[model samples]
Target: MTTESSDARPLPTLTRRSGDDLRCSIARTLQVLGDRWTILIVREGFRGHTRFSDFRRVLGIPTDILTSRLSSLVEAGVLERRGYREPGARERFDYHLTAAGDALLPVLGALAEWGNEYRPSGHGPSRLYQHAETGEATSIAFVTAAGAVVPLTDIAIVPGPGENDPGVGPTHPLAAHH
Candidate 1:
């Protein structure tokens, strides 16, 4: 005998909460990616960094912090240590981004665009990107499938009524009084 679709299995339960204070999805996502170095490593990894020294040289990250960040990223599945080698100059190994890590480029693009607008000038960017053809700033934007620019207001925050809903929750600072 065959069981019905919904009857075949029950929804898996949450065996543990993330932490005492952080309970939301955004919080959980941030818990993994929120490290200051994670996104930078991701950005550099996208630019084709596959070794420890390469990340070190590009980011100028402190050795201790960089070590922690790399380990965290590997555990988070954002990177994978593909092989072990001792080039006679080293005793350990190098790391590479998995396909999962390569998929974070859009997030980095969004962040870069936001920073370009909000971050103050004179606070030099460690590096910059330019168009190969014209050699001008590489401005990032979001476009739809048919190639139309998507505006920020077009984005919506949809949270069902259960866990959290800001619309009906405590008023935000920007919220208008009713």
Candidate 2:
């Protein structure tokens, strides 16, 4: 079933406190998706499980926890809830991933790659990402704006604009560059 709604409205922007706030993007992202169940729910969404029952059945998530995660996701704009009704049944909602949620594909891919390397199941990957048309295997990487794929060894964490805030102390040696 499709989750697109003709009357769908844009989600509100989430506001974070400025100055003295943790300047870590990863930490900020984790604020919304730090829990195991939240990530698994998003995985289920990618697997095309839109309805609550489907998510419960696939993940074996408890109803209360599943309900809380879905609600949090919808609040965080990761999932959009669309109402539907069947025959004479009351209207219910199906959760679909928003653009923000869909953006987590690479995060999931990277996690899968790491798990396959460090926490293998002894058999092989249960899932593999591939190019839709070419059918070639795909993996996540750090690519530059000019399209250069940088190796992990070459990556350096530099201070960003947020890191330059007066309240935030220089935690990295490169902070002087800003």
Candidate 3:
């Protein structure tokens, strides 16, 4: 099935299998952070928990799983591993968030906000997002290039430049629209 977009172009109907051949940013991102444990490790990184033992203790994650997740994050450029050693002790590594990882703050905030609203625990929010300098509350939204915050109802998803790549040819539905 397909739907006619505003420009009278037919939009591709996506299914679980459709993403397998598509150049999708969300799909690529999920390859790095799809699991609960991986995301929680990122949360720990944001909270300044860098040591392996600190992550294990705080999240109660199994040693093998934590090791795998941390290794994957490092390989994906989400975390940077640096060597640190105390005197007379064996060298160890601490994980720090790279720019790519630090940029996930807004994604984390959006996830938290959605959870608080739709999956409430019946008590209250355990945490809130606020400005560091002004202490003002903040929330994420779809902002236009002109700095206008558009309502969710007004939002639309259209083909980006990636979908319109000339090399991809008309074999891809959206590529034909370009």
Top model number, TM-score: 2
* Tens-place lDDT digits, model 1, residues 16-125: 45453244645544655786787888888878887888999999999898888888777766788766667675456578877656666657766776676789466766
User: Which ranges in model 2 have alpha carbons more than 4 Å from their true place?
Assistant: 1-22, 164-178
Order the candidates by TM-score, highest first: 2, 3, 1
Q: How do all models score by TM-score? A: 0.62, 0.81, 0.80
Worst 10 residues of 1 by lDDT: 1-10
Residue-by-residue lDDT tens digits, candidate 3, 82-121: 9999999999999999877887898899998999999998
Give the winner by lDDT: 1 or 2: 2
Give me the candidate number with maximum lDDT: 2
Q: RMSD in Å for candidate 3, one decimal?
A: 10.3
Alpha carbon lDDT of each predicted model: 0.66, 0.82, 0.80
Error at 62, model 3, angstroms:
0.4
lDDT of 2 by residue, 1-178 (tens): 1235454444334455753335666666776788899999999999999999999999999999999889988987889999999899999999999987887898899999999999999999989999999999998897887999986666676556766555644344433565
Q: Rank the candidates by lDDT, best first.
A: 2, 3, 1
